[model samples]
Target: METVFIVAAVIIALLLLSLVLVKQGHIGVVTRFGKYHRMMSPGIHFKFPFIDNVFNKISIQHRSIELEFEAISLDQASVNFKSLILFSAKNSDEDTIKKIAFRFIDEKSFMQTLIRSIEGSIRAFVATKRQSEILVLRQEIVDAVKDHLEDSLNHWGFHLLDLQINDISFDEAIMRSMSQVVSSNNMKAAAENEAQAQYLIKTRAAEAEARSIRVKAEAERDALELKGVGNALFREQVATGLAKAGTIMDAGAVDPALMLYTQWLDTMKNVAAHSHGNILSFDGSNDGFDKTFKQMQLINKSLLEKNTH
Candidate 1:
């Protein structure tokens, strides 16, 4: 009865060692006599007792890590980058799981290679760009790193899911200098605009002033022409009246000298009526009046003869 109990105990221990449980999101690699044999899926998996062993359990889930590093730009400026990287196993195929299991000595070594590859790719890209271009090339940098790392990671049975650049920054002095450059450019644009505006204003003012002068000169010329025309018309009317008066006097068989004397008297009366502070010194004697009237008569006789001719 004691021998039977020993055999049963050994069987139970063998059974316990043969059964393996693999949790969700994980894959178990089985090895026979320390040599790779097959892969075990999640849940209860039976293997040869004391001959097959659970070699390595690899998680197929996505994993993330934060990275902070510095890169030197082509312009010899230091750029700091903060980023997050997501990675996972390529697939669940047996060959893929085998590659992942045997790619590196351990998870730590695989992670080191991955991190170094990412850093190398980033540094190489950054070395070719200027400091001013680094801030806006976050997506490009991520793309370049993925492109450079895709084949390498695939060889190790891994895939790059995502890469995020959280922050990019330059040195304090460089930042201040960049700000000054932008401010100066804005100021230059403002100055150019102000100069153009002033030029337009002055040009318009000069044009307006010239137009005003031209208009005033035109108005004065028109006024002078109208006044001259009015004066000419008045003189013509007076000449006609005098000629008619002379003709009437001659028909009546009256002396034209009598009409001349009456006109001289009328002129003196008008001068006296309209005089403001003007002095009129004229001869009041009949002899002086007769002399002046004779001169006027001579002038009128000559004008009438010329008109008749």
Candidate 2:
């Protein structure tokens, strides 16, 4: 009875020790005699008491870490970077879990290797680019690092999900220089735009002035043409009236001298009526009038004889 009781007690103790409860999202790595034996999924499992041990509980869930590091550009400028890295165990498969379990001594060593690999890849890429190109190539830097690290991380049974560069900045002096460069570019653009606008305004003004001068010249030319036409018509009418008067005088048997004297008297009367405060300096005596009239009568008699012929 005593032996049976001792045996029963030992069995109960072994049963209690063999029962293992693995948490969700984690795989239990079992080892026998300090060597990897098998992987246990979440839930209850039975293993030989005192021989089988839970070596490591590896989480298969996604994990994230923040990184801050400095890199030197090709131009010898120091650039600082702030980034986030998301990674996870490649999968929950038996081979992947085994690799995760045996690859590193502990989590600290794994993290160190991971971070250094990322930093090295980033530095290698940045070393080839200038400081001016760094800020704009955030995504490019991430891609270069991921491409470089993919195979290596797969060997460690991990997958890089995402890499986000939160901030990238240069040193203080570089920043000030960049700011001044941008300001000067803006000022140059403004000056160029203002010059173009002024040129357009001047061109438009010159065109308007040319149009106005052309219009004025055209108006003056038209007025001169009309004045010349009026003068020609007036002279023609006067010639026609004088010829008719001469014909009438010949038909009435009137002397040409009488007609000449009458024309002189009419001309004096018109000058007196139209004169503005001006005196007529002409001889009023009959002898002086007869002398001027005799010259006009001789000229009129010659014109009448020519017209009759």
Q: Residue 135 deviation, candidate 1, in Å?
A: 2.6
Which 10 successive residues of model 1 have the least lDDT summed? 255-264
lDDT per residue, candidate 1, 136-239, as tens digits?
88899999998888889889898889888899988999989999999999999999999999999999999999999999999999999999999999999987
lDDT of 2 by residue, 1-309 (tens): 999999999999989999999999999999999998999998889999889999999999999999999999999999998989999999999999999999999999999999999899999999999998988888899889889888888999999898888999889999999999999999999999999999999999999999999999999999999999989998888768777877798799977677777877898899999989578788888999889878988988788678779
The segments of candidate 1 whose C-alpha lies over 4 angstroms from its true place after superposition are 1-9, 186-309
Model 2 TM-score, all chains together: 0.66
Candidate 2 runs further than 4 Å off: 1-16, 208-309
Mind sharing the TM-score for model 1? 0.60
Top of the candidates by lDDT: 2
C-alpha lDDT values of all predictions: 0.90, 0.90
